[model samples]
Target: MSDNYTKIVQQNLHKLYTKLPPDLERNLPGHRNGQEFMFNAFGEKCTITPRAITLGDANYPAIHGILISLYALNATPEICLLSPFKSFREFPDSMPYVGAFTTHTEQLLEPHVPDIRKSAALITRYFNGEDVPVQGGGDFAFTLFPLPKIALCYIFYEADEDFPASVKCLFSNNANRFLPIDGLADVGEYTSKKIVDLICDVNSPS
Candidate 1:
């Protein structure tokens, strides 16, 4: 499986490099250092060149590698549209992944709302996030970019006497313009996991 993913990522990289976008820096919204493009991915430093994509000096996972390459290949000059965040169900052809998206992205964070709230500020900083006004009313909410072109708005509702803790994740209006539906779903999953990891880091004995 890993080998297959490697081939896929390599192929995508080749396609992206063949005719690199002239305005890659603006499209990717990342820094271009010579032939290398540097950006923050899932809160980690990601450097992509014609040959490979690395996150903090290590090879990025195949799935994520593909998403990054795709993001670059589809790079567009339009600014990221963050207002009017939309749910996964709002995207066309998103029905197939809606259940999994909810399970992996939202419900996955339900158990840690408190811990996540504790580290919300740190998570925002780690992901170059911006605090957004809570929409629809919630305990708190914030927007963060896991990729240069994609922004996710996360809203949290703490457990109350009648309802259990819950989480909601919404995407920037133009998120689909950057990656395909499946890729966007994976982004949600991975970003959610990264949040859980951050909470774990906070709890780990220092």
Candidate 2:
């Protein structure tokens, strides 16, 4: 990566990370006590774990950065980083792929998963009306480019207010609604076979 690219990624990551509140830094465990933070969860539960949050039980915060990091690891410059919210004035067509993802998330995917519909609606709104500029972060596009743009919403355990209680609720309620934090075995099983295959390859050794 160029010094400029690295610099930009570093700066933006810092900008975003600083926004994280105490919960992200919290050492608390889940009601299950067996559970861990969304990102920290491994094997099967990793994908299901809601994202980390900010305030009021908070919302998932680290998702975009990590996705961008994946994109940076795999994609090229022509493809932009897309989020639902865009500052397109500066980004132009080169905006990141996250926005395209938002559409997939709301229009096609969320409707199929009503259990999390309320949360999905809110996340959809967050990305709905914007043409924001892309702050080129990491070179994670390599991972993002191969797949169709898909929106990702991180809820964490924020659905509940009390700490471990909320987290337990989060896991219980959405146990079956796990997003592909890193692809689990059946992420896009039928919709796009080719893309799913590619993802599987990426997960496997080249």
Candidate 3:
């Protein structure tokens, strides 16, 4: 991201932190201890402190920005479990700009089947090890709880005789309770990119 974007995120965080009610702050979902909040970032536990957001011992700037923005918005973890999954376009009143990213989900994974499969395997193995449920959908699928209330589903379809491998990213219908469509797009893209990178590393020839 750009320096300006980073500054903007920091500013928004500080503004939202000040406006948050004590009761709401204390009860915010996922994990919490005083002003520090915790949640899973790409399968790893991370803590959001007043000074900085840390994934283990290291600081992840991108995750830090995303988490702070979510917290500042006071995102709730109450997912609409009864609602069926929906694509970004299906979201009510979704902005037109987001269609560019949402509509091209398949194209994004067309060239990365090997890495995508590897990534999905790793996710299944590690998450199952921790008892997180992984559901099957077109080859591979799983639900990710980036925030307590926000759930993102990633589905990967294997290449067939007539079609190339593809991926679809979906969100819970109630996701609007947390961030706007733009933020949701950011979260989805970021998570997708992270998964691809992890898979590439695992499949890299040594």
Candidate 4:
């Protein structure tokens, strides 16, 4: 499966390079020097060229590589509009993936709310994000960019006398302009996974 995924990523990179856009920098909202582009992806530095997509200093899993490439391929010149964020289910034709998106992206973080609240500052700094005012009076909330052109806002509600802990993930209003719908779902899942990993690392014995 890993081998197959690698091949798929390579093919996607080929496609991205073949029809490379002249305004890629503007569209991706990333920096370009010669042929290489640099940007933040899921809280890590990402470098992309015609040959490969690398995160930080290593080659990441194929899923990440594929999503990064797709983000570039679908890059648009329009700036990201984050106001009035929308939920995954709110998007057109997003019903099929909504359940998985909820489970993997939102619910995945529910159990770690207390840890997240404690480390929210660290998480925001790592992801180059900032705290945002909660819209509906939740326990806490913050917004982070999982990709250069896409921002995700995570809202949390602590368990209380009558209800259990819950989380909600919302996308920047125009997130779809930078990736296809399914790709957007994957972005949320991967970003959520990154958050969990960061929390685990912080809690691990040193």
Residue-level lDDT of model 3, residues 169-194, one tens digit each, is 67777776677776677667666665
Q: Which scores higher on TM-score, 1 or 3?
A: 1
Better by lDDT, candidate 4 or 3: 4
lDDT by residue (69-181, candidate 2, tens digit) is: 33222322232224332221122232353344334322333222323323333323322311222234311111111122322223222222543311000011221222232
Output the lDDT of residue 76, model 1: 88
TM-score of each: 0.96, 0.21, 0.77, 0.96
Q: What lDDT does the true structure give each of the candidates? A: 0.90, 0.27, 0.61, 0.89
Candidate 1 on 1-206: residue-level lDDT in tens? Answer: 29888788889988888888789988888899999999888788998988888887555556888888888888888888997999999999999999999999999999999999999999999888988999898999999999977999999999999999999999999999989999999999999988998889889999
TM-score of 2: 0.21
Q: What would the TM-score be for candidate 1 when compared with the true structure?
A: 0.96
Candidate 1 accuracy as lDDT: 0.90
Model 4, which residues run further than 4 Å from truth?
none
Off by over 4 Å in 3: 24-27, 59-67, 80-82, 103-106, 124-137
Per-structure clash totals for the candidates = 0, 39, 2, 0
The lowest-lDDT stretch of 10 consecutive residues in candidate 4 is: 53-62
- lDDT string for model 4 (34-90, tens) is 889998988889989887778986556568988988888888878899989999988
